[model samples]
Target: MTIPEPGGPDALLWSEVPDPVPGPGEVVVDVRATAVNRADLLQRQGHYPPPPGAPAYPGLECSGMIGAIGPGVAGWEVGQEVCALLAGGGYAERVAVPAGQLLPVPAGVDLVDAAALPEVACTVWSNVVRLARLAEGETLLVHGGGSGIGTFAVQLGVALGATVVVTARAAKHERLRELGAAHTIDYREQDFLEEVRRVTDGRGADVVLDIMGASYLSRNVAALAADGRLVVIGMQGGRKGELDLGELLAKRGTLAATALRSRPTGQKAEIVRGVQEQVWPLVEAGRVRPVVDRRLPITEAAQAHRLVESSDHLGKVLLTLG
Candidate 1:
């Protein structure tokens, strides 16, 4: 897949490209499927660019079979089924992936569906579990609860014994609740702050997994418990906002933001290892599952992008290779 120029969904083109060859410590994958992510949309529109050393394509995660291994690589063989977290290039039929980023498809998960797991699983684990340190009996607030990341965070938070509160449109509330949200706030119909307060008995959320970014900064701070942590992972709502440092200081709250795509190879490897060890078991056991709204052929890349941008889907919209 190629983007001739940054613009709308039609900018995505399925054109022939040179195959990726693995370098040392890397592996080449014959991609079976790739899931669309918000980051891909940003890249397609020229608002975001792939990090240096990543491919020029738009995809961030894929599932496939190992096609080749580079020199100095070990413990993985050609023809092994795997899903991988990628910085870019997943939109293609073949992509070069860092060896450390490859994850075996969990038992009971179809190979194609596994493509949805890597990005969301790693992101939720790294930020919500590792950074936020959400504990049993605590409260978690997840914004955009109908999205791929939102759905994953909801299940994972619930599985870990935290009371999960989610913000989504009214139509998605029932499904989100079935996915383990303890409470669902219709972000369009109600004030999340008031609902959060009502649900928590005035205490506030212990941790907030935010995607709206600056637009929600103040309210997210207000929603925090004393000693709370706010993890901002996306900026869909805009990048700049005013924050009241005094209020944050008084609450003893911490604000941290992260983007997985730009991390160093080693750091990404660490997160991938952590996800394999800590999160995969839950997936294999069926405590969490991929929420795929629809699957489209890779050639329908533009349609897939439009689906994601519309935000009408309940979960991930996947693009599968022939």
Candidate 2:
């Protein structure tokens, strides 16, 4: 298997390493496409090392056909089209994933496009549905509206009958509005808190999906309504800050922080099961679709690294094997 190295993108060499075989309860995929994510960037930077026993290759999720199943694997076949949440090894042409982590690609969507699904949808659904308990007819705020997770959040929040407010660049406002952002605040030109307050009639949002961590922390709390839940999925801005615990407690807000890549296999499998039951139907019915920013070859991972590092991509970016 030839895969990108962990440490700088410059160290991403295509070396022919040993191929992987599934252990009991595992399955291997013939990868068709893999999506680049912020975690992939951190892994390449050496700040985020794969967990002990996790594969060293960078990919966290992928879309592919099942090549083989290991002992004890069931309810799946050799020729299934699967979009998998991998425990690494996604950058390689062949990746071994736990059987329970594999989700069947929706019938009408292309497999390569399905590569864009697992991480973003799982992130949005897990944080919004599982953690925050977002309810219908409430207001939800999503930071980074043009991102893969944001796109999914907008659609999912809307499909569940929540009014959505998204922070985006002005260039993305129209697109976000079309995707069900009832209010779009261009972060470059306006304050998200003010716009959200105005849009929600000064009641604040019922839920907030935040990628900007400490930088948005106080402001996010300020933007939450009574008993609002704030789920923090990433700290793209900065990590440390002093919070007004008094204000948070007064508002009765709850904050939850989580990461998908570092989760225990059982926990991830449970998330996969929930999404399969609740979210996959939306995909099959075309109410939700993977938003692909672009696709490139896996061998050109050097270029792929540049694309993600630039932070200019609007949605999920994919890399395919030859």
Instruction: Give one digit per residue, the lDDT tens place, for model 1 in 1-322.
Output: 8888999999998899988889999999999999999999999999899999999988999999999999999999999999999999999999999999999999999999999999999999999999999999999999999999999999999889999999998999999999999999999989999999999999999999999999999999999999999999999899999999999999999999999999998999999999999899999999999999999999999999998898999989999998
Residue 242 displacement (Å), model 1? 0.9
lDDT of 2 at 308: 73
Compute the lDDT of residue 195 as modeled in candidate 2.
90
The lDDT values for all models are 0.95, 0.88
- Per-residue lDDT tens digits of candidate 2, residues 1-322? 2334456567777677678899999999999999988887888877788887888878889999999999999999998999999768888889889888999998789999999999888888899998899999899999998988899999999999999999988888888888888999989889999998898889999999999898999999999999999988889988886789999999999988898888889999999999999999998998888888799888788788888777677788899986
Models 1 onward score TM values of 0.99, 0.97
Report the error of model 1 at residue 115, Å.
0.4
Candidate 2 regions exceeding 4 Å error are 1-8
lDDT of 1: 0.95
